[model samples]
Target: MIPRFNDHAANERTYLAWVRTAIAVMAFGFLVERFDLFITYASQNASRAAHKLHMHLRLTEWVGLLLIVFGALIILLASARFLRNRRDIAHERMEDYAGPVGEKLLAAILVLLGLFLVVYVGQELAALSSQPDM
Candidate 1:
């Protein structure tokens, strides 16, 4: 078998980097959602404008939550794969690698994620268009 060349340190570093990115995304999402909640509260205290403001705030919260969950899951799965690859490399069992199955699955997941983003954007745009002028 070919000698293992996978650097555990480098792989670990990459995994940590991804984790940090995931944390950042989650934090940002939480902040955005919280901001929306604050807006909702403020609108409730306000006059007639509260209804529209609440709608906008709800949309923001939903979008933010979706993005945060998606990002976190992606990072988690990527990190898991990276660690698995590193382990396989260390064992010098490169031949037993996910040769085709893993690749196909990864591709499918990426495509699904792309489609989801496209649909989400389209829906957001549609909602915006349907709303009255602010």
Candidate 2:
């Protein structure tokens, strides 16, 4: 009757951490999307070129959407992993830890998202610098 409380507790803690991270990512994504919408609405009275520029700054919207979706996927992954870990610990088969394919995929996606954001910010700065002083 060996107690596996420590193993189960650690697994629960990891699962909770993952959920918290997912929530933060989703909230940030929503904020980004909402901020873009606010900008678009607020610039409706601006000149034609300004409106065009705002319209062209559409990448944030897409990035926000991708982040929200990715957060959801992370939640699902975390849930599945948690259940699998619990089962393995109960059965004393800890040797069969889940594979790293999903984690690798997540890391790759995160890298791509970060790169996209960097490029997007650079473009925005360039465009802003080109504009005449108000």
Candidate 3:
């Protein structure tokens, strides 16, 4: 039987969870980055004057790209953590995670993204409501 099989299994499970999260984040980023397509399609039928209106989500583009970058970073971080955790599990006493910086950074970025999206959406709604009907 493998020694400390439960600990090893738990470590593997945690690593897998991180991988899943990373994939999800990347996928969501791709979706957000593609918002440009929707905007273009929407503007296709708009009057020439409407075309001049500023309706683009420039910040959203940056956020989406950042998310994709973060997702890749997550994979790297998870792999490093998994390896370290595995090594620690082999010792008589496991040491604390050296710097937890990656996870903390990810959390902080996500929170900022969430807040930006909220404010962006709210502002867009207000602008839409204020505009005169076409």
Candidate 4:
């Protein structure tokens, strides 16, 4: 039997959880990016003047792309961490990983993203409220 099989299995399970999270993030990003298609379709029937008036930057696409990139980074970082932990376990020198640096960074990033999204939504609402009725 492999030495410390349970420890290795636990490490692998953690790695898989990270992988699942990464995939979820990427999928959400893709959904956000696809909103552009909906916007385009909605604008198709608009008059030229209306089209010109409604034209705006695709912020969602950029945010979605950033999310996808962040997810990919998470996957890479998680793999590296998993390997390091496995090595440590093999050598019987495992250290406590209570909130590792990478996880802390990810949490910080998520907090920032949440704040940015809140501010962005506020700005959009304010803009809509200030616009003159058509």
* Tens digits of lDDT, candidate 2, 33-128: 665665465445433376565665575777788799889989998999999888889998747555788779878988887787678667655665
**Residue range 1-134, candidate 3, lDDT tens digits:** 98999999999999999999999998888887777676556445443345333445565677789889888988998999899888888884857657867678888989988898778667655655565566
- lDDT against the true structure, per candidate, is 0.65, 0.76, 0.77, 0.76
Q: RMSD, model 2, all Cα superposed?
A: 3.0
Per-residue lDDT of candidate 1, residues 1-134 (tens digit): 33544466677777787677677667766775676665555444444355666676776688669658956885878678787878766875645545666447646755764576467547545655565555
List TM-score per model, in order. Answer: 0.57, 0.80, 0.80, 0.73
After TM-score superposition, the amount by which residue 114's alpha carbon in candidate 1 deviates from its true location, in angstroms, is 15
Please say which candidate is ahead in TM-score: 1 or 3: 3
Native-referenced Cα lDDT, model 4: 0.76
Give the distance in Å from residue 111's predicted Cα in candidate 1 to where it truly belongs: 16
**Between candidates 1 and 3, which one is better according to lDDT?**
3
- Candidate 3 residue 98 Cα shift, in angstroms, is 3.7
Please provide, for model 4 over 10-73, each residue's C-alpha lDDT reduced to its tens digit, 9 standing for 90 to 100: 9999999999999988887787666567545544544334444344336767877888999998
Candidate 3, clashing residue pairs?
Answer: none
lDDT of 3 at 22: 91
Candidate 3, which segments miss by more than 4 Å at Cα? 41-57, 97-101
